[model samples]
Target: MKNSAVRLTFLGGVNEVGGNKILLEDFNYNVKILLDFGINIKDYNDQYDRNEVPNSIKELVKLGLLPEAEKLAIINLYTDYHVKKNQDSNDLETNLDGIFVSHPHKDHFFGLSFVNRNIPIYTGVFTKKIISAYYKCSKTSIINNYGGLNWKLFRTGDILDIKGLEIIPVHVDHSIPAAYGFIIKTSGGIVVYTGDFRMHGPLAAMTQDFLNEIKNTLKILHQQENKRGEIQKPRETKVKLLICEGTHIHKGAIESENNVEQNLEQLFTKHPFDFLLVKFDRLDWDRFRTFSSIAQKFRWKFIITEKDAYFYYLLNKDEIHESMKNPNIIADDHILILTQGTVKYRWQEKIRQAIYKEEKGHRLIKYNEIKELDSGFFFYITSLRKDVIEKLNPNFRGAFISSSVDPYTEEFIDNNRTLSRFFRKIGIPSYRVHASGHAMPHHLINFIQSVNPEYLIPVHSDQPHFFKTFFKNSKIKVMIPNKNDRFELKSGIVNGSGVF
Candidate 1:
């Protein structure tokens, strides 16, 4: 490879839905940044059970859970405490500047806990809070601790000059708040990476703002280049490459969050259930807010698991998106913190104190209290709490709403089946009311067309071929990269079209 070339290596998120680890190396500028170093959920589960996950980074790398240390070539990326235990290998060197995390999702930032504490991890301001809240609430696992490392926070519209690369993080609408897509200007060319996003989300306008910013960046790049060279006619697109996620590319326009709310309300009204049990992704604050609002609307108490309560309490402490902030989770009579198990972690005790100190009523609703509830309650539970629900002994008047994505993996499929059987045994009718976090196929196509990059590389999808098919008539060259595939981009063009 030429020293001036910009190289992109797909280490993980290829032909998969998550576990996105992309390495971008600009040797000309001496800039190396890994975008979204997250573990692929299925791959991680396949390698080891939750109870048997390795704590050491070396062990994880040996098991192919992380990028190979030799290939990364970044020294001090892992703490000496983790790598020094095994003396067979020499220490890795450094040119790696930082790992830019796009969001707080486990599939995007879970692996940070295993990284070296010295390397700076960049994340949005609210994204950092959510990740830290996750770490504080959960057991100190490799994924949860996030390595307790150096964290540099940035908000939308911030221009981060890491070495020579200029990374502009623009907020994008995903399932979670503080999700971002980046416009990175390298010596070779401009590379636009669309971190997981959707157009039909509640905050779809944020995604549009990101798209507008990309166009503005191209104009800025043109203005800067015109100063040194002959004035050339502007092309429709100037972005050298675009890396995007196609998690739901096979499906056409999915339902919007508003549609989800409408469907959920319909279900609630149709059933008129005395009490409700709801399940959603823990970090899905939008869905949590949706349910909580409905509970308040119905004059029912919104009950959340202690874990959810912890996140809600933390998020409420700061300024965030207006639609997401809710003082009710901690202060209102309409909210209840459901505590079934004894407090195990120190964080749980802190949560207990926060709730008791802030809320006036005896808001801690125990599992036994749930059984005695006659009506007017919305109990939120996580996947691990299905057994807890069984213990609650819900009445037949209760309904279960699975307000999360449908199972896509084998393990999740099996778990869903088990949950279904349990729901059946409990004699409560179950409903699936959810909106996907990813963009629909049509929206994704429109987004790529709008960006109009010289080359388009699709990741975080099982059906990558869909991108090729959709872009065949367009000018975009859809590059389907496999795991660990490397491509050299020099002077705004790929050196070779064929796989390396």
Candidate 2:
């Protein structure tokens, strides 16, 4: 590691969409920071062995989920090498400087559970709350406990001055709220990392605002090159590298959330049923809002799982009523169905009290009342409970909307095929409706052009080469970065070494 070069190492987020682990090294100032250490959600141990999970940091590094940081300047909280209790007093501020998280997605933030609690982790406020909720509620072991981490909840424009590198979180719209893209000031130049953003969501303006800020910053840097010291000279003027996500490159373009929202209203109006069902992804709050808006517009009742109801309230506190906010403890006698069964999980016992009450007249309702009604209401159901599919009436005309990923992929097709058979047997019809949360090809091109970086490295994409073809003969040099490829950035020229 030389003093003049800045290094960008890709540990996982290449060729595949998740399992993102990136290391950003500032050799001149002896600073090392990890961007995101996340395991792929799609590759989660749903059908596999839970016993295979690593209980310690050494196992994590061995599994390639995290990179070895012994030579790294900072201390890691989770790893044996950097535990505060074992460290000598003189070597306290080891090599690692800080860790910046883009969002709370499992692919980006789940790995934080294994991170050294000593490292200063920077993220958004809402993202922290969501992660805490997820860790507390989820039955899956993949979501490690986040109780021990050192968190510095950075806002939209907060600049993180770690050593000599300046990192800023710029808000961007995604499936989950409080998603962000980052602008890092390094010795090589300004580097922008887009952490899974889309320009068609409700907060599309936020993404635009990020681009505008980048443009302004680049303009400012281009105008002045401070020659105060040799140390400061290499870092001055304009952005050198743009590390972006191309999730939708070859996955086909999708309409914005607005289109999906309108379609949902039309679907509800066309087929009003006794009990409509929709599969739920806990983090997909935009989808929840879409259904909520439909219920409000049609004057129909909408209910959600208590787990989801909590997140919904967090997202829509302004729209929800204060009276509906109750401590989710000790079930009420009024909740007939939720009380009938002996609930084992703490969340299960409190779910009825948490989600059954009326909120702003439409936010929360009970399953008992909805099933008794003749028609005109739908409720959200968790996919974990497969028995729920069996409980639907065979003669009912209710519709089930699969707003999450369709059965197009191999992993889901069989389950969905079985679900299709069950739905057909029951008389409840299912509908597929969803809008992707990633930028489309045209949108990607527009954003790339707007930032106008000297070098472009695509991450979280299956077809990174598509970017090369799309931006062929353009000013942007598209480099398809591979896994574990250490990129040394010196004067904006990126050279790679296949070393850990």
Candidate number with greatest TM-score: 1
- The residue pairs found clashing in candidate 1 are 75-92, 75-93, 113-146, 113-147
Best by lDDT: 1
Model 2: per-residue Cα lDDT over 369-451, one tens digit each: 43354456556664534555454444556777777632322111234555556666767687878887788888999899888
The CA lDDT at 119 in model 1 is: 67
Judged by whole-model lDDT over C-alpha atoms, candidate 2 comes out at 0.67
What would you estimate as the lDDT of candidate 1? 0.77
TM-score of 1: 0.92
